[model samples]
Target: MPSCLTCIARKVKCDAPDSLSDCGNCRRLGEECRRHNPVPMVVSRQESKQFTRAGTKRRRSQISCLDCRKHKRKCNGELPCARCIRMKRECEYDTSHGKEGTFHHSYSVQAPVLSSIQTSPSQTSHTSSSAAGYQSGSVNSPYFQSDTSTQDLDPLAMFAKQCPLFPEKELMKSLVQQFFARIAPCRLFGFLHEPTFMMKIDQGYGGRFDEFLLLAAICAAATKVNHEANKQMWESGVEWARYVLQQLILDLNRISVTKLMTLVVLHEHEYRIGNQSSCFLITGLCTRYTHILQLNVEYDNDILCQNSSLTASEKESRRRLMWCCYVMDSFASSGVTHLQLIQENKIEIQLPMSDEHFLFERAIVTDLTPDTIDHRAYLVRLMSIRNRILNYVKRFDKDRDLWDPQSEYHSLLSSLQEWCNIIPENWNLNHTTIYARKSQGLLSPLIELWIFFHLCYLDLYRVVVPGLSPAMRPEIDAVQIAAPTDFLQSSQEACFNHAVKLTRLLEASIQHEKDGPLDDPNIIIGAHEAIRALVSYAKVASSRINDDTKQLLAELVDISVHHLRLTQKRIPTAILGLRRTVSIIKNSGLAYLNYTNLESDSDSDSSQERPGLEEQLNPLSQFSVAARGLSERHGKGTSSARVGSECSSSQKSMFDDDNLLSPGRDMFPTSLEGWLTSNQFGDFI
Candidate 1:
């Protein structure tokens, strides 16, 4: 019997089974067990031809690539074979060179394969055989080690090691359900489809990395329900989110709607954690990526009208994502008028439809134009109004060539009033039924919409607000040299009245939140801004106002302050900023009264530089300076500066005889009259 090539090469005894084509040794080793003919002499061309005709046909080359050979594994004998592709390594076959059994030197660049020819076991050393996949010291590589391979580098496996048991298929499903039920009901989070999202999650770890990132984000958002049971889930969700982010960076560069939505989720998470700066940065990325994906553009129905074209779901998804992006970009960059990211006019996409229509991707709700709109449409309208308001405010900036407040103020006010007049019956602020709906969660979106509307309303007219504009900070060189003032009594009264309505709404919202889920950071911060505005108005107008007006402002301030102090723990950063501004105003108010009294009384030193009426009445002037210093101090680090940092010992000492609201102390003013007076005073004391 002819011995197999491998047995002959090793000089081992041939062991065969009569029933099997392959020899016993070769079969057991999973090697290509072909028989070899004995060497024959070639006397002449005619004799050689006769000998070749008589010889049996040898089997085709069945040898594996160099990598498989080194690992003692099976390989399909193709150039750049399956194993090479999976391992992400170069594949090379052995080629004949100058002599028999000699390989081309260049073949070593990729791990060179061994020739299929026979060789003695003594001649082929184990070191040389094993070195097929390596150079000197290459064994130190993790890939070269037996335990670690390309599979070990999988992000899912790495993520599994970090976040075990969480997002374990069933748990992830439940969390996703919770997200849709709780958070997704909000218009801002309506970007993803329930069925599609669930189907992707069903793909498990084998699914797209972007899908996993989205699921992780959903998990994080769902866990925001503020229950003790959800604490572990929140932490696990955060871990998984981090894992997804790490994996996303390593994965393909394809930017999909899923990635944009994931970023939005992460942005909200940052905002929830009071990381406004991070939120702004992430929103910018989301906006840029959204624009790149052309989600901001309307679906080309002319091209996509065919059967295989973009489906209703796809179009709706694009619209939803685009709208959400617009909302977030507008929301995050709302206060900083010049920093807005999305250009509203550049977007030509349709606003998202009703949740029912969008969710099922059905055309059942064909009456797109309506006198009264749904919550989603109402929100889009509000965003439009907000966009207009922001644009109007942008014109007030001194750097803008269009800085003409007198020309624009009436038109802007008219537009805002038109918006208020056109509010749908369902969204009417005065309707008790609407309040009932809000309590029942039927009008949940309106709660935020109202707050956002008021926030924008406040921002629009704040430039002309009486106490803060021309009369407030006239002494500061920057204030004087900065934007030109356009103080109007109508803008002033309108601003204060809006502040009153907003503060009332905020107080009610906070009180309502006592039994509901935790307030979002937006609501908290919006409320904080309202409080700051109210207190500033009161602080500036207190000395020149009547006792009744003083009491009214005082009540508003107290309620806002009470709600703020109650919810400060959940949103310490936001609460802390407002607290600092309030503390500064209070301290500065006290300083103003003391300085005035010092100048008036006979016991005072004549040489002392008494503060003028501007400083005495408008303590915000000093507060602004100290606040700038505080921002400079805190801007250097990630950790929060104390609320008292807004008013330093040096700042407070300028007003009060002592450090009234230092880090460890509460901001309780000793005298309401000293800190915040109600009675009107003449130009002279």
Candidate 2:
């Protein structure tokens, strides 16, 4: 039953009983008594067949386009398929199957066939048998056979065979857990999202070669934090991981984020092992890969829409990886422009989010480097500032004046102060704050962050303090101000204060090592720089400062040296650098009191024999004994006469060379400046 259109339009109820019947009101008015009867949809035979085929599922084409087949995408069975045209790839179909009367396409035998495709009964039976074999993990299955043929060729497989740890799933899992727990929290290694990475590990790395490589690298890094009992086992695993990663570098035909992550970890591992040259080369490789991948720029929303495979977490990881590369570049370049591969102006990617957001895979938008105070983002920002400082310091010869208010030096100094002002109060290094951060597993990163901040001040202010920075000594000497100006005095005072602060911070960090050892190699460099600044100031200010001030400076140097000795056990480069610094202090005739012995002696009231002040002030007279000791240890000639002759000649020509820090020279230099500007110190940095 339905209402007529005329009656309904007139706002009256219809009396029609069916859709085809006329209404009573229209019939009485002698108007057309029409009802709203929807006409039946008619179809031609061809159109009916098309409709039937659409509902039942039309058969797939007997062939696929070449481009579609290569990329494993769907084809529309047209001359040029939609995928091919959209991807801008050439499209061509194989017509040879048409002549065989049995249509066929070249596909992997493991690929499932569409149910609508027509196949011979024998083919159907063979496919069923193959499916059963595949399900059972039989070697006879084509997919399994193909995997077997290339199993030995895979680098990860070779690595697994070589790595004893990889075969022990439990041990491997322990090391992986150790890495994420200890090492991955550092800002440089924060690119990895633990939940996603752990999920992949629980699924056996999802059969990905890159994931396996990253896992191997993780195991190697974790070994750095391992105990001494397993040192040999850890070393073997590290060596195999390094070798396999080196080999994999040669086979990289495409760029991937996982591969970049592996290289980043391996770069840090290289630095930890004292291979600065390898670290430099690897950083360059990573920078090139980063550029090729365009990780420096955020993906356009349109591009992100087209690539459905990129998840929100993956996008965040890309941004983090980009920042990691920037950090590595900053360290490797160390302010040398020719070595700088990634420029800040070129970086358009957003800074990393907070660890909470990143680890939980939240897709929140974050501020850029200058705005964000998130731990990871702020670390990158500080790194950018440090890079600018280094570049300005390195190019001191070109700068007009360090004291000018409008100069680059003042600009960099202002930036450093601004950075310090923005630091949250909780970041302060005290016993209570240290313990609080330790409870949250953030003690190491907090210490490292402040260490880096102090290092920037050391590099900047040391340029004006004569004998402190070897690189700037000649340039500063050329200016030759007779009496120190207010600016120069302020710079010297700033340099000395920061050096003392750096030493104290390091001492505090070492005393509070209940959580773990400081893993960052840069900590060692910071300690060395602090010691250098303190010793240099002691030498120049010996006549001006009182005995108590001299003793205080000596204690600071001892504290820094103690830290170096402790770090030497973990980092090989630290051992050599520490020895050199010790030799320099002894030869320079600066007070080399042992801080721990001083404490014990004060309690026992036992007097320790100390070198006389006259001998300490005479730097040239004290060089022979220290030089001979170093020479004898290195298997060089131990004759005091030869050592004296070399010391005399070194003092005469120490400032003659332009590139004082050049490599491949004497392992033990005679003068304090020689030791400060030696290749050993340069390579350690």
Candidate 3:
């Protein structure tokens, strides 16, 4: 059974004696093939690199340059290797150098100058040359730029002429600058008669070659003179403008935020101990996303409806972009943890990466730490995790329509269940045995929690709501994690509750600022909606428990309550008086409301006014409806309504039959929470 690999691989006869260094065919062929070590049929997938090391090193392709990726050839990966040097090409590394990647342009110096006064971008301050001019480590920013002034940025003028997206550079600059207006103003009170920055972003640079970064720099650098009265960032749409660069970010593989996150991970040492500014930038970006998305979701009646102002294709593109950013934030922050671990270490660090960190994380830790072990195991784990993620992504791509909860997203939750069953709980984070405690943090948990919540809400509760019927329900398999109290044990209940609470708090604090006060109505509203939904969800979720789930449920209750009171909501504060009322309603089946004040003010006509009697008023109310599930369990239509707003005359309230947020019959089965449970078939689906 003895064999020679070289001859077998070559399809030649293994004529040599089976010795470490005496293969006869190799000897005849003048090739050194003395060994025939058995290779494992399956690689661990973690030690992929080690497997390569066992074999001969891969030869560098004779070609060397970034473009080599597309050309069919081996890459020497050289600095202008023979091919590139011969062809007069610049050797480019594919590292994606983070946010700094976008601005780098390789201009052929001989291109003709435009025969007119050249125009500079409104965002001229962010020019690549200026970044290039900055001495490394001189400016604290991870991004380097030229010290050149805006007026000298003639490249933009030429950029317009040379690039397809930039015809009429002057007009483009003016438009981009004006677009900043909707985003720059102070306080947003929910409604704006003015066009928003998102409108411009959705419209203006659809395919424009980024002639605007230059003007953005100019605007960012200039005083807030006419820029809408120097509004505080969190005050209004300005945060949107500040992070407008992220418009480029919403893509699946957004190179910009990924790069910025890359820079943060790579240069963690510079900002780690206390990189307040970078921290501020990140906080703003996340806050903006939170507020922007909250607004987008809540605007059922406002002009602020989602990218609807854009064409159908644009709307879909923007939606995907936003979701991608949300998803990537999970991995990117996990990448940041590599940096955090450095300061946590008691010993001196000397590596570019925590051998445990991401490839992006490796960019930071390894730079700081000295080389040691091959870190083959960590690499394997990362690759395996990535592969599984790719599989999930593939599933999503295949069923794009069902990816959202309103559609059959719950069917996708089963995929997550498979993931839960398979996701690794252990990891090789460090070389040392003492400090290498096995754990995966932050990333996996966030992905798990949101997907789980969406499943529970979308699938199980869709059909049961009493008042509104969805016109159509996407076909999706149901999960058994219902709110009926019969599906789970009391002991394990806390696990589910804790998961939901953590997701809510995380969303609330996504853009939390350390120095700034938190008072924006939109931010407040976002936190309120998330918290209230989760809180209501927890209340109903408790129905699904057995005695076994008691402790877990109790612990979850503690955590959820602790966080609930920590937020700044006067409504919650004032309603704290209703604690007993709420507890009674939840347990004893009574809608809690103090109507004594109304009784005292009965003399007032408005105070005495009650819900108007329709042509037919159900004599039966909350209890009657609860027993039956609903007056009518089936839906009337694919009903969706904007919460907390005035409905237009033509449009009927999905829950107009009852006040769903309230516990009255009006708030019965059709209440959002009730709908989620009844229609979706419950049990975390």
Candidate 4:
């Protein structure tokens, strides 16, 4: 046995001295020896010539010119094909190949010979006549050229064909009525007028793409809330609406208020269906379009009069549209790193009139009073006030001596109280009998307003009281110490107390299964705020105060979990959000400690008995894991971000009435990052 060539090249001995077989080096390394030649190839001159011709043909196909593919013509097997030479265009062939013999081309980077290509055409003039349109400036004309893709797939035409398949005009009329009765009165956003909308429907708005899309969105959302139509109808409506909007989006220049309204409604529909990311993306576009239309402009009487093209009623609708954008933007950005789009001080327009006057297009407001205004108007005013308060908090420096507890914190509290005091007596929480008729209608907003009112106090006081780590002591050291005169300390207590009360209020509001207040997205966000405030307080308070708050926190958690269980069939994302938020809290270790006996336990016993944060957080962690498993199995997507504590003046609490809580501020999760890093919550998220 002799050594293989590979072994000889490496200067290593190949040992096979015992037998005449493959060498040890070749066998072990699985390398062919080729050291001994067994036979030699023999070919006739004619055979070699035939092989050469076959190789030439194969290489010719591999190196075909680019001009052949673009014009759908055959290449002449030349470097510069006859067609390329005649047309004076570049001809390229991709020759790069990997070890596996796969060709990679960057053909798209080269200049295209034709501006546009027809997918199908008669063979008689495929190439020569196709360029005629580009040369004649037909491509440059303002009139839209018919696109084959869109021409064949008209959503409206499909709807028209399918219209008779579903319930006819009666169903459409019922949906319209239901939208006005429940959805419009809620004033989710100002997209339509009762009179104008009804008139359009009477005149047959089915052919108008913008109006059709809006109607689809309205019907989809209304069906979900009221359940008058079958689920399939709503799903089909959403599908058609999405198709129409996608086609319409190609012409961004043609976007109108109606189109924007259609988008807003679609955003709501997607949100209602628990499509969180898609819903947020739609709102992003909606916000961008709102700015493009300058809906943010606060047109006063003089400005309105100057613009003769806009009627007074039109001006009012614009104002409503602007405020609606503000409200929706505020809601979506809350507790997230996103920035709120619209600002308050920049808007100087009047609040929308009562729904009656606005919907009827009344020319004048002779005897209108504050008490008679729409509930939505109250929401606008409250949001405006919250915007100012948010600005104040953003500029506040904890170390600054100018911080006035009475003037700053108390003033905000008084404003909320004033708002509560001024609403008509029948609107008061105590007058439940008066709300019986419109309980379903009024309860959602009323609970949201109430929760927001409490949350406002919670956010304001949390930052001020028990003060964060580096806060400066108050300047009024000489002010009478306690004996019922220490409003600052009283305000501090109010923060924790409000946190407790807010949770109870939410629990109470959700008792009615159908019209539960927790069904509102903002109200659920309010629950997160309540939970966040309580957790922050527990972490910051002394053992005695922590003991009192622990029970309240536990109660709130039960209330949230129970409420989610009830609404899970309707809004599953709410459950997903709750699970993530709870997991975050559990990982912080605050969720497990029994504050009542924490001080009494001997240090040695406590060390042995108490479980680690991960151990205590297991239930929430397991629940989320199981829920997510189910979601994946069922083809559902959960929210990636969860609501958390204020963390900083820059980052808003989920509880803020408006996402504009920190005006002129861009959020950074300095507090959240530090907290998560310390607790290793990053692994969980």
lDDT of each: 0.52, 0.60, 0.30, 0.50
Query: Model 2, residue 636: what's the lDDT?
Result: 24
Q: What is the lDDT of residue 451 in candidate 4?
A: 72
| Leading candidate by TM-score | 2
**Runs in model 3 lying further than 4 Å from the true structure:** 1-118, 121-233, 236-413, 421-558, 561-685
- State the lDDT of candidate 3 residue by residue for 1-685, as single tens digits: 3556666656667766545555776666555563545454435422342233324223434323456666755565433334443453333433343665433222111112211111223222333212211111100111112222322344544333433233254444444443233221211100111132234334332211222332332233222222223333112222222332332233213222222222222112111112223333453354244333341232122222233333222222222223222322322222222111111122122211222232111222122122421222222223233323322321332443432444433444454454344333332111332123212212222222333333333222323221111111122112223323332233123333434554443333332322111211112222222333333434545465445444443344333343333332311221221232223224322122212321111111221122221101111111111222223433332232222123343234434433334454343335667656664422332
**Cα TM-score per model:** 0.61, 0.64, 0.27, 0.56
Alpha-carbon lDDT of model 4: 0.50
lDDT (Cα, tens digit) per residue for candidate 1, span 340-454: 6678888876667766666666632223344313566667767777666655553354433223445565566666677667666656776584467666564546666677677
Model 4 per-residue lDDT at 590: 67
Candidate number of the best lDDT: 2
- Where model 4 places Cα greater than 4 Å from the true spot, the runs are 1-174, 223-238, 279-281, 297-314, 332-338, 365-368, 391-395, 398-403, 406-411, 433-440, 465-489, 516-518, 538-542, 545-554, 584-685
TM-score of model 3 relative to the true fold?
Answer: 0.27
lDDT of 2 at 302: 33
- Residue 479 deviation, candidate 1, in Å? 12
Error of 3 at 373 (Å): 20
Candidate 1: how many backbone clashes?
Answer: 1
